[model samples]
Target: MVDELGARFATAGHEIALVGGPVRDILLGRGSKDLDFATSARPEVVERLLAGWANHVWDIGKAFGTIGCRKGEWVLEITTYRSESYDPTSRKPEVSYGDSLEGDLSRRDFAMNAMAVLLPSHQFVDPYGGMEDVANRVIRTPGSPEDSFSDDPLRMMRAARFAAQLDFTPDPAVVAAMEAMADRITIVSAERVRDELIKLVISPQPRKGLDLLVATGLADHVLPELPALQLELDEHHRHKDVYEHSLTVLEQAIDLEPRLGVELPDFVTRFAALIHDIGKPKTRKFEDGGKVTFHHHDVVGAKLAKKRMKALRFSNEQIDQVGKLVELHLRFHGYGTGEWTDSAVRRYVRDAGDLLSRLHVLTRADSTTRNKRKAEALRSAYDDLEERIARLQEQEELDSIRPDLDGNQIME
Candidate 1:
């Protein structure tokens, strides 16, 4: 089918190449059914060419010089050679079609994504040594890093995304550029930043990406709460380093996803884990003996998480779920000695509602204490709590537990 489509463009006297990330993926042996092709043909011409051939075609990206179509099971986005640049004060880019494939490739965010394969003949094109960078598992820009990031500050976030997705390291120069231009990310839309963040969080190595974001000061602007975790200081190293601890909790939560029956890329769970302790810095109290206490941090953190999620343009449902998780993350600590009554167990299930499983995962992951005995005791207590919940659930359907009377009945 690819060959057929390639032949169609070749016969029409247009130059087309499978380009950008798709080409990079092909080289990485992770061939994708979602193909991106750069063509000398304009959007309209590309639409006309795909009319009879594709099973369906859509103009979702037409304004951006891209024409989308699906042929059989394969989805393809055919785009004209185009360059997009952003005005320094503008949140959006002004797009202009380019005349050459190399020119279009030059505007891509990363060197690994700057390669292409000329269609019909299947010749490879790597004008900026992208193949070498990909082979070395290094992230770099096709041109000057400053110019590339200045053209689109979102690429700074994309660097973190790629780092997470591919587990690749950015070149020192690229890292420096990101550090220098970190504040420029504010010019990009919150929605775009949120999307990049979603990608990074769901990637297999989210910790690595998040570390880069913090190290480069990108987190300071994009997620101030994250870097704020660094302020959770302990002079003697007695306390768990809250910033690193939160990241460790995120890793542990990701590992628990499959066992806990969470869907992969569960944003709510991961975000909850990462932001669960954000309130500690705000609630810290120093005692006479230098002990730090964070009373009611769960409640404070939940409110802060909601505010941050709203700023990042998260959906209301996502905000609510993550906020609830953050608020409830500390509740399990109160279930000491497994002495709760059946009513208390029901209340626990009721408070958790549909998020009980995720709450369980978060509560467990939150135990980053260094003492093995304490860790084992916490795990054992949680195991006992789970058993009690299961037994109660079997006997009385704890998931559907409710008040014996409706609001109207109580009023009467």
Candidate 2:
């Protein structure tokens, strides 16, 4: 299928090459199913050629010169050389086609993604030393980082995402550019920002991406709640800063559950991890004795998470799951310390409902602290709680715990 597509593009007097993530992954010796091809040919030409051989062809982004062609289970994305210019307010770009491969490479978001390979010959083209950056596990822009990022502030998030995904660091210049242009991210749509955030949180090392967000000042613009979480009391409480603690929680979540299968449940867990402590800022209080307390922080955090999710236009199911997770995050800790009563456990089971396992994963992630003994003890308690819940479930004790208990039956 690849060969046939290659031949079709080749016969049209255009140089077609596998590019972007597919090429990057292939060079890194990783398996990639999404195939993307860069072509010197125009979008229309590419579409016409693919239409003859492929069963399905779509102009997913024809205005920006992209065409999607599918053959059976295999899908290929083809795009002509293009450059984009953005208005100050919206992330949607004003795109124009370029005539050469250099133009396309120059316009890419990162050096690692800029690298392309000739399809038939399988020869890599690294115009901006993308190959060297990829080999060294660095993420740099193709040209001036300032110009590249200014053209699209969302690239700042993408840079962090690549760092997390590839376990690389952004070039110093790129990092500086990201910091300088952090506020500009507000101009981008919340949906675009959310998508990038999701990708970063799901990466192998989510902390790397999140740290970059905090460091680059993007967090202040994208998620101002984080900075609010950083406020500290004098010396009363030794709890870590809320932002740092959240990152720790995210790292722990990724560690505890490395692979969350592609589904709504997985995304909910990740989103919950990111916003689990969101209420701390709103609930913070300093007592007369200098004791710092975040009373009802979980409830406040859940409210904040709902607002943020709504701003991002998350699906209703996703919003509900994340909000529920944030609200009940502190429940497991309470269960660990207090009585694991049947009523209490039943309440948890009812609240969690279909999301019990996901909630458990979130609880495990939330146990990150400097106190190793405390953490371990909590883990053991959690395991016991799980066992108890399982036994209760097996005995059908929870079956009748539903809210629709029969007042009519009682009357009868």
Best by TM-score: 1
Tens-place lDDT digits, model 2, residues 222-326: 777876777764674655678777777866776666444445326678768878989987888877777678899889888999988889778888888999999
Tens-digit lDDT track of model 1 for 114-174: 8989888899899989899889999999888988888788999999999999888999999
Clashes of each: 0, 1
- TM-score, cand. 1 vs. native: 0.94
Error of 1 at 74 (Å): 0.6
**lDDT over C-alpha atoms for residue 348 of model 2:** 92
| C-alpha lDDT score of every prediction, in listed order | 0.90, 0.82
TM-score to native of every candidate shown: 0.94, 0.89
In candidate 2, position 80 carries an lDDT of 86
